[model samples]
Target: MTRLGYQIPNFTYPGIAADQLFDTVVAQAREADASGFDTVLVMDHFYQLPILGTPDEPMIEAYTLLSALAQHTSKVRLSALVTGNTYRNPTLLAKTVTALDIVSGGRGQLGIGAGWYELEHDSLGYEFGTFTDRFEKLEEALQIILGMLDGKRPSLDGRRYKVSDALNVPAPLSKIPVMIGGGGEKKTLRMVAQYADESNLICAVEDIGRKLDALAAHCEALGRDRSEITVSLQTSACVAPTHDEAVADFEAYLQRNPAAEVRRAGTVVGDPDEVAARFADLLATGVDGVTVNAPANGHVPGRVGLLGQTLAPLIG
Candidate 1:
């Protein structure tokens, strides 16, 4: 299980040049590897998310970057925080993750979710369907992805996708864990109970208990042990050595991306002590772990290490 995970959601650092962007990212990954983070994630987006920056801002292709990161770091598992299902065919995604696992020496996890962000779908020429449509597609995709990972040629003739004898050669070095991300009690949590090794909820701190209850109910309905699925919350945080400094960094980031405040329900903004208090409250809600994105000052050198070490001991 990922007791602590670091998510790199924003790539537009204040002073970094475009040519130096990847090097900056590598530095953070290396720090995470050395620090206490058990997993390292990047958002799976073709364009910058609206909450972070404009679409034209830098967004690295997820798998390519993760594969590159595999060479520079060890120990921390690699994955997209939550990969969108509409980006590629299910078979292709399975192959991609398997290859990533092999390259990373069995340290890859597939964190996937039903596709959202209609803008990317529309702009990138992928189908932007309704909620039901996307979820149904994700259901079928999971079957194919899961089967392929287990070294079986899965054949599915579903409404959204159809695959016959899809083969994945050079299978993963080990069983690549599947993490399903969403908070939908009916479809999403139920699917997590049926097909996933982890359930990542993308809700506010206040909603964690309710979402987890729903997951437990789903697990019970299927006669599956709720403990079989590791629960994680996706959240935001700004941590520094001092409370005043962390608040300043948070406010400055809000200034750069004024639209970010709308997504602050689960956000923690303060020094290590203060942030640890907030995380303590979250951990009390029954989540097994957390994956936090530090958009405020994550790209700054040494920030990732500070956040990791500060929160590592508190995860238990």
Candidate 2:
């Protein structure tokens, strides 16, 4: 059965205060938990994009926010949508997740990805390596994290990282699920097939089939069942009383952020029934989960609730 999840609005709202944004998110998470959403995911970004707002605008650190979230909500699964490999040492990152899992009673998932967004890295004085170099680092970091989580002192000497006798204390109470974010067929998909417990793709109806096909090939190469790896998609969402209202709301949002491209190629933005139907289509593609990115201020809470309350049942 496919599960439906929601991404918390962690970025600063245009006119909202940082503390207010955090409170809004915590309250929304409580509502989402009560509304039956399966997961509450947050993105790991150091700065707000110019299109979204400004770099200097308020942005919260991901793991710190997650620690707060662990205390605020009890039932929902929590995770950073994908933590960048460039941001923290792998051993340290693994230890952080282990602690979070323990504090959250084993409801944490670790989502890791190769770092992108060079502007943030440059502004923060982090190394912005070539694409290949970044991917190598990510792969090495994944190895370190997995090894540490397995309660073994792992040693690695790789092109990008060298680790010897790493220990992560207080192993996760449960086997923490590792989620890899990206659709890079060559390396990312192959790594997901080999290592990740779940994989996330940007939602694009026309391309979803193709992405899954590539993932299937990767699974075949690894001698694993494609079904063993949960499939998830990220989408921008808008829903209203009618299809027309939904489209208008989405267009209004686009108008405000003209430079921001609508990257959710496959999205459901309509009345509850129409949204439910679209989710059903995703399930047909072997998607086991959908993580909807809803707007701030409860603009579409009804729609978000409908997804978990109505759509998930239909798809499941």
Candidate 3:
């Protein structure tokens, strides 16, 4: 199981020229690789997320970044935190993930979701449909993608999508973990029970128990053991040497991005020891692990290292 994951969502670091941006990203990725993080993740969005920055902020292509990071980091699994199902053709996504797995020596996971972010869709000309429409498309996409990942040519002429014996060549060198990210009870959890190898639960800590209960019910209804799927929280950890310092770090983050707190996903903020205590509470809720983005200063040199060091032992 991947007990710890380091997510890099903020690419706009102050004072880092555009030409040197990826170098900074690579540096932090190497830090995560050397630290105890088992995975390195990036958001799959064409624009900067509202909670992170303005639309014009520097946001790179997810798969491109992952393929490049694979050369720099050996230990951490590479992936988009959650690939928007609406972003690409299902067969193309399957092929892309396969190539990433081979390039990374089989260290990759496919984290996908029912696409959100209406702005991205409306701006980029991707269909911005209702929630139901997106989920339905996601279900069909999954049906097509899973077969391809399994080395089977899948053809589907379904209500929402159609594929004609779509071929995926050069099968994955190793099993690529499939992680679905979201906390929708009826549709998302049901799909997770049926399809996913991992579930990255997205909810505040206070609500984790309820979400877990919902997921368990879905699993039971589907005749799948709850333990069969590895579960991790999509969360944030803001840590420093002291609680005050942690508070200051979060303030710094807010200054950097004034729209919203990405940490709202589920946050544990404090000194390392205090962070450990909060981590214990999150784990006690039955989640197998956590995927964390320290948006506060995560782009700063050595900042991700501090987070990994603070968290590794608790997860280890």
Candidate 4:
């Protein structure tokens, strides 16, 4: 059985008071922690994503929010769904994550990816380069972070970044799992096989088994064991007392965001029993865990608890 995680992508939900934005996010995080959720994640973006809201929608700094949430919760692991590698220097990012681990009592996971949001980069004064440039930076950044994690003082003059005896002291209490998010098989999954502790992918559920097969091939080519890397999927989840309401909610989401097209295999929407049945198929695809985004109803008081009651037992 795979583990269960939750992601909160939208902070500007209907009826949430403006002044109570963090308050609302904290409430949801607390609920998930108390529930059976093992990990809680947020986006690492400066602006609201198009699929979720407009440019001005509420968006908090990823590390700042996670640090504050850590003080309020005790059980769940915390991280950005995938921190944009270009947003900060690799050494600085490592230090920030280490600090988060210290504050969270070692319940920190580092989720990173090659940045894709150009609008936020342009608006926030970040240098937005070509796709190849971004990937190069990500690859080099990983080298630096991994070196630091092993207590090495890495000095690299890479194409995208230069570091001088970069050291990450006061290291995490435990070995922080590095979660690489993306499914670009050639580069991303290859990198995962080389370095990542976990890999998170959002793809059509039908493709999951195939993706896992690809990952295994990458592992074999690199002489790495496939079982050493945990595979987690990020998908939409809707839990209701009846299948009809759950499907209705999923439909409402699609209607609100036409770009958010998803295959039925990638979505979980139904009553407890129905949800469990759907989840079984997903787990069968060799996924070791899941991080579901239920932004629509996650903040609704007992909604997260209800989801845990229904799905936690079914999850690994």
Best by TM-score: 1
Which ranges in model 1 have alpha carbons more than 4 Å from their true place?
263-265
Q: In model 4, what lDDT does residue 191 have?
A: 91
- Rank all candidate structures by their TM-score, best first, as comma-separated numbers: 1, 3, 4, 2
lDDT against the true structure, per candidate, is 0.90, 0.76, 0.87, 0.84
lDDT per residue as tens, model 2, 222-261: 8999988888877656667688877776666566555444
Off by over 4 Å in 3: 261-266
User: How far in Å is the alpha carbon of 196 misplaced in model 3?
Assistant: 0.2
User: In angstroms, how far off is 121's CA in candidate 2?
Assistant: 0.7
Clashes of 3: 0
Give the per-residue lDDT of model 4 (tens digit) for 1-316: 1268888888866667888788889988988888798888999998988766678978889999999999999999999999999899999999999999999999988999999999999998998899999999999999999888767899899999999999788878888889999888788999999999999987877788878888999999999999999999887777877888777767776666554563345567788888777777777788887888786566667767777777678775
lDDT, candidate 2, equals: 0.76
Each model's RMSD to truth, in Å? 1.2, 2.5, 1.7, 2.2
For residues 176-260, could you state the per-residue lDDT of candidate 1 as single tens digits?
9899998999999999999999988888667888898888899898999998899988878888889898888888888878878
TM-score of candidate 1 relative to the true fold: 0.97
| Residue 136 lDDT in candidate 1 | 91
| Residue pairs of candidate 2 with colliding backbone atoms | none
| Model 2 CA deviation exceeding 4 Å by range | 241-252, 261-267, 296-303
